[model samples]
Target: MNAAVHIPEYFEDCDLVEGEDLVREPAFWLAHVLLTMGDPGEVERYGVDASAYEAMVDRLADPGQPWPVLRVCFTGGHTAYVVYANFEDENNVDFFVRHPAWGRLGHLGQCGADEAGPGLSWAELISLAASAQDGEEGLSDPSQRLLLLLPMLGDADMPGGARDTVARALAGCGIRPDAAGELAASLLGEQDSTGGPRWTVTGDSPIAVCSSPYSPRRVPLGLGISPEQAQALANALHGSVPPTASGGFTG
Candidate 1:
């Protein structure tokens, strides 16, 4: 089947169901995002070797204590993620505390990357994956502003395949394959194209436009965790946050 057929038209405008408080304990919360939204290439780019990460799937399944849940809040300028767990050290803090979603809460102090550059939310990430634009950078302009990426890479079961599926969908929309890196760029504001952006990843007047340099490195997720498990984690985190004073956000 043509995977492009499933791609959404307005990648940035795609609907996202806001989750309640999934993040309570920052460490555990960070782990959850690392499990789900972390960018492996970013990790590698920062000199963090993938080989050094100890696969935590086994720990997540410990029955005695399942992995902590994380819920991230979304906004036009930033994202906020809450975690529920007993955090211990810098490793946990480094992974989640520095995450883009949680960083919106001033959790990272001046260490936040999005403060100086374009960052993305999971919703935006998914939207880019399903759009006709380049998923990563390097296809055309490396400094394009249409795209934003979060540093967290993979936690979902089908990492590489999943990335490919989204890429194919975007390509179906007419985006070039070389622009794959754009998929990780930040999605900010709605674009009112005069005649709809060209699906072509290259050349001016293309269907989609990427705003930054997208790294080509495809990161890895831990083994054994299923998409269902990830969804469950998202749901659990939702139940933890309290509602707003206006009677909204029934976590």
Candidate 2:
């Protein structure tokens, strides 16, 4: 008998169920996304280096390499990913970016654990990748406000008071008060058990912040505020009393 005819018989001893669960599996979604991607040549028009892009594609396609452990999709149809390449080493994770436009892929670099601090979280990686493409102003777009707050929202060490402060600040940026709070709460719910490390302000020239030790990325703060104001905001988010003279965080 043909192998096709024995397909059912071959799996008769295996347990099977019919429903949406199989379709909803991570493996299924990964395969679907990979299959739908256009030819990598399309990415060349954007000026991406052919060799590097091809190497990234090869690594992703290699079954011997680790599969992407996490994927975050932005409102603008951009996607960020983290692939854990080594289980024994905490720093052996790679960040990758992709957009629906050309399905172009870019490597954001690898992150690993270090004695200095914590590594970047998937949310921060998404923000960095998005900002690189759309610039800081894109982060402040009213439609993307929630995404802008994700790095802070996903910080497990952020205090409730700080969260409230951030929500109020976001409201000042044009989001409805009630909507802002609800959105923050909803995002928190989604990550209640998976919050990453705390965010710490490490510089002032441009207001840089780090989420963890040995992180390869440092996110610049201040959606549009002065350097001093950004410093105050970072302090407030860390649960410190902002100088009353600083006027508090507006954004």
lDDT of 1: 0.26
Alpha carbon lDDT at 56, candidate 2: 50
| TM-score: model 2 vs. ground truth | 0.27
lDDT tens per residue, model 2, 37-128: 11222433333344644555444345454343444444344444444343332324444444433323433344334222223333342233
Candidate 1: C-alpha RMSD to true structure equals 20.8
Question: Please, what are the lDDT tens digits per residue for candidate 1 over residues 1-251?
Answer: 11111112112322222112221222222233244334434433322333433334234323344223222322221222222222232112122211222212222111122222122322334432223222221111111111112333221222223344333333333334554335422211122344312222233221122232331111111112344433332332223333234322211
Per-model TM values vs. the true structure: 0.20, 0.27
153 in model 1: Cα distance from truth in Å?
1.7
The total number of steric clashes, by the backbone 3 Å criterion, in model 1 comes to 47
Q: Candidate 1 regions off by >4 Å?
A: 1-147, 166-175, 178-251
User: Considering every candidate listed, which one attains the maximal lDDT?
Assistant: 2
Give the lDDT of residue 142 in candidate 2: 23
Q: Which consecutive 10 residues in model 2 have the weakest lDDT in total?
A: 1-10
